[model samples]
Target: MTEVAKPGVLPARPHFSSGPCAKPPGYDPAKLATDVLGRSHRSKLGKARLQYSIDLMRELLNLPDTHRIGIVPGSDTGAFEMAMWTMLGARPVTTLAWESFGEGWVTDAAKQLKLDPTVIKADYGQLPDLTTVDWSNDVLFTWNGTTSGVRVPNGDWIPADREGLSFADSTSAVFAYDLPWDKIDVATFSWQKVLGGEGGHGVLILGPRAVERLETYTPAWPLPKVFRLVSKGKLAEGVFKGETINTPSMLAVEDAIFALEWGKSIGGAAGLQARSDANAAALNRIVEARSWLGHLAIDEASRSKTSVCLTVEGADEALIKKIASLLEAEHAAYDIAGYRDAPAGLRIWCGATVDVADIEALGPWLDWAYASAKVAA
Candidate 1:
């Protein structure tokens, strides 16, 4: 094949990282000028701002009143670990892992926590058999497998009257996917994923059932202060009310507020979902037209709209890296390389914050990179 010429068009923004995704459209650092940087997070104004962020998230997610939303220390990992340590020992546990992040949680449960959890797993681009999941045991799974670009098609497989809690690591799913809240007992996400906000903060949402578990059940293991969501056999109501377990970055909180506001201004969660869907669809068109590229997800229904992973035909790891580097060097894309542990390919962020036009612009760059890579190889 002949080398393709560099395209004249370029993505308006070259950021396509799955984490710390592209900033919200029209984002300006000046928007965060009002951040309460030097003020105590517990001060009246600070507390109100924190509460506003919680309320806004609740509103955008359309969470039921029975659910409690809180800001927790650490990113999604912290929020997830907090739930695992606090709740798993109360019952037998099952974990599902399809990608690196999910595998990390499985390791935490079986190795660190020593819960001896029953783990159901799949390779990089596939989903475990949802029908085979033992729901009677406390279940932990990622709603979207960030590295694999595979997502659970829906929550239909989860029984409504199941005997155990459902803990969902939804860091890369929220804002871009519609979550069946009633089916999820505990859910966690980071600010840097779908919302394009700063990192170092995690949002934890507990359904009434999860709160009940926290109030009534204590794990067999010791609980760290940071992971303690309950006190003296009672739920830590203050935590749910924005009294963080530790000091939080007010600057990140302000950026989160800004992102949430931007989400709302663009028609809330539905609008965000639509934006991500459009971006993915735009890219899919290019992938469909090109014989050399395809989605990593084997099942179309399971494909992710947020982190769109791609595999190039007959390409090795080195070539994939070369293609990514070429695109990066040309400033046509950044951080579009696949996860190290995942199969060699490309991972593009088509989340809400990224413009569809940028994704469209990326198609030609991908073509050029692939052609250049093939010639070099």
Candidate 2:
């Protein structure tokens, strides 16, 4: 490990890449390995660590007894696909796509499942009208659009007692915001987002309604071993326990446990929310002060506190990319560019791993980048 030193400089501000963010301040890689990685996941010690992880997650989220949490395959994407493949055929599907990842899932539903999907799309900065949705149909949506930095305000509009299931991809919103669980049947998130854990694994949570859907309705297509939610119409017990369906990266598990423990130490969800809130508030102040910078999300309430997307006034794609390139080269920021397929601008991940002080540092860098871009153009 290399040490960073400068006479007047504070410690390196946390890197704010959208995913796989910089580890928290004072993260000890060696300690995490020793504390979480010595045993096979199947051994008694492994099981105890896994159980502790689950219990801590439940306590942090205040989950109900009826809900079940599982460490599943792949990242959040894997957990989401499993739910879509297993529990989706009961009713007509209503999918929402406001950003890249949401659109990716919609594509999977169209191509992989070959299901006729009714996709509701919004431009990069906007959200689809919830009033326009049909509550009678099963719904799939990203509660927080990670790429676009927009989020659904609340689940309040999701008809209280709808007939169909609600599958939400809450990867970026889980710890940083209040998720009204009653409105969702299945929710998925990866530890890498807010938790700053290792990647390649996903946490899948199922509400009682989703479990019933799994038991009552099997898809017309054959299920693969990894995606299978049930054996003989009963949900797998190992899923909720430490027993994963396949071999998992024990190191990644340890990293997740470490992040979760850190979350608990900082006051759990409330602390995480404060971190995000402070970062967002700091960035919003910057955005408001600048004439050229404006948020991507149109509605104030729906704007995400985790990933804060900003756009330059009348800037073209090439200019936006140029500015992003400058920031990366300077090491003032990284992964702050907008998604390639979306309208171009700056995108900042303001999750819990990111510090308010780091975001404050970013404001001047952004102003400098914007001015340089305008001059070059």
Candidate 3:
């Protein structure tokens, strides 16, 4: 292949890391509310901001009143772990692993918790058969596979009359998709994901069933202070109402509130989903136009609209690194490298925060990087 000249025009914003992803376009850190800074998280104003953030999330998610939403520590991982530790001992466990995050949960269930969960696994770009899930077992799965760019198509597979609770690790799935809340008893996400807010905090949404499990069932293993959700055998209702188990970063909460307010200004969840879909569509156009590029997830139905991974034809690890480095050095892209655990390729964030123009501009830079890198190799 011949050398392709470096693209002169760059993306207006090249901030596409899959996690701690691109911030909302036109985001000004200076614009974030500073009143909450240095205030005690337990103070009246601090609690109000937290509750307001939760309320905005519920509104955006269209969450039912039967469900409860709370802010937790440790990002999405913490929220999900808190759910698992509190709820899994009441029934059998089933874990579906399709990507790195899913695999981590499987490890937690099998090794850390010693539950010997029924493990159903699939490789990158594929999903385990939803038809095989047993409803009697407490089931856990990632609603979107962040590392592999695969997502569950819909909630049709979950039985409405299932006996066990359904837990969804929805860090990348929320906002980008219309989540069926009735099908999910427990769900977790971090503001840093779709909302592009600061990290170190997670949101946990619990249906009535999950709350019941927490109030009735106790894990055989000792519960960490951060993971405890019950007080005196009753659900710690305060936690759900903005009393977090630990002190939270008021700055992070303020940033999240800003992102949530931004989301509201742009037409709520539907608008956010549309933005992500458009960005994904734009990237897909780039992939479709080039023979050298294709999606890691072959099936369109299960592909992720938020984090979209691309397979480079005949590219090895070194080649993938070269493409990412070249684009970064040229200020055409940043953090566009595929996950370390995923196959060699590029993983571009197509979440709501990214602009479609950036994705469209990215195609030319990718072309230059790939063509030049191939020549260099």
Candidate 4:
């Protein structure tokens, strides 16, 4: 093997982690509004700020008025489970998993909820057959597989008139894709994904059908106060209007606002999606030129644009670790290792917050790191 020399140039910002991703360009912590800090979340100012974030989310996503958007307590996991716990037992269920997080939903369905859902799963690099899915059953799926780097090509598979609700864990796909909101009944995402906001807060979006489920059906299992969406046989309307069930970190909310404003300045959802596409394309250029690096998700159609996973030739867990370590030590990259449960590989965040130039610069650094790691091994 050639002893590749170290790359002279380095990525301007080498933070390629898939979550708690890089903050928006020009993000200055000092610039964030401080008035909301130290105020009770229940105070009028606090409630307005929260509602503003929700409004920005709705406008950016082009979400229909038929759907309700709210800030939930936990990140994506918390929001998704809230949906599953409250509305799933009311009907037949189907769960689809293609990555670690999706598998988590399956586990919850079968074990935690004991709902006996029909499970449809696929290996890391592929999607399950969408044709075989029964629309009559409430279906749960991740809109994007953050770990495996696979995403549904489109929402075409979900029928418009299906009898059951569609629940999507969409942490990494929200700002990166032009989702078919009409087809999704319940969707959850974290602030930390495409927008690169602070973590610990989740956004839950409920379509008309999801609201119907919440108001009409109560699960046989007991509901935690944190998990409760309905109060006295009615959907807790206040929650959708910024009345959170729990106190939220005002700092995180402000951080999200900064990201959202940045997103809007660029062009809202469309602009953010275009930025992510460009970043992914930049990385793909590097991958196409490299013989040793290949995408874990082979099909371009199903491949994810945000958390792009790559398979390194002849890589084992040890080698993968070394590559990640070498890259980090060189400040060429950070947190680029694949998910713990995933196969050995690299996972790069190509979200809107990441500059395309940085991704382009990452190519040589990756080559040098891989070569150095191999030599050391």
All candidates' lDDT scores?
0.92, 0.84, 0.93, 0.94
lDDT of 2 at 139: 90
lDDT of 1 by residue, 301-364 (tens): 9999999999998888999899989999989999998999999999999999999889989989
Q: Pull out the clashing pairs in model 4.
A: none
Worst 10 residues of 3 by lDDT: 1-10
Question: Which pairs of residues clash in candidate 2, taking residues 3 or more apart in a chain or in different chains?
Answer: none
Report the number of clashing residue pairs per model.
0, 0, 0, 0
Clashing pairs in 1: none
lDDT of 4 by residue, 213-316 (tens): 88888789898899988988999999999999999999999999999999999999999999999999999999999999999999999999999999999999
lDDT tens readout by residue for model 2, 116-174: 88999998889998888887889999999999999999988898889888999999999
Query: In candidate 4, which residue ranges exceed 4 Å CA deviation?
Result: none
Count clashing pairs, candidate 2.
Answer: 0
Please tell me which predicted candidate would have the highest lDDT against the true structure: 4
Candidate 4 has a TM-score of 0.99
Give me the overall lDDT of model 4: 0.94
Better of 1 and 4 by lDDT: 4
Q: Which has the higher TM-score value, candidate number 1 or candidate number 2?
A: 1
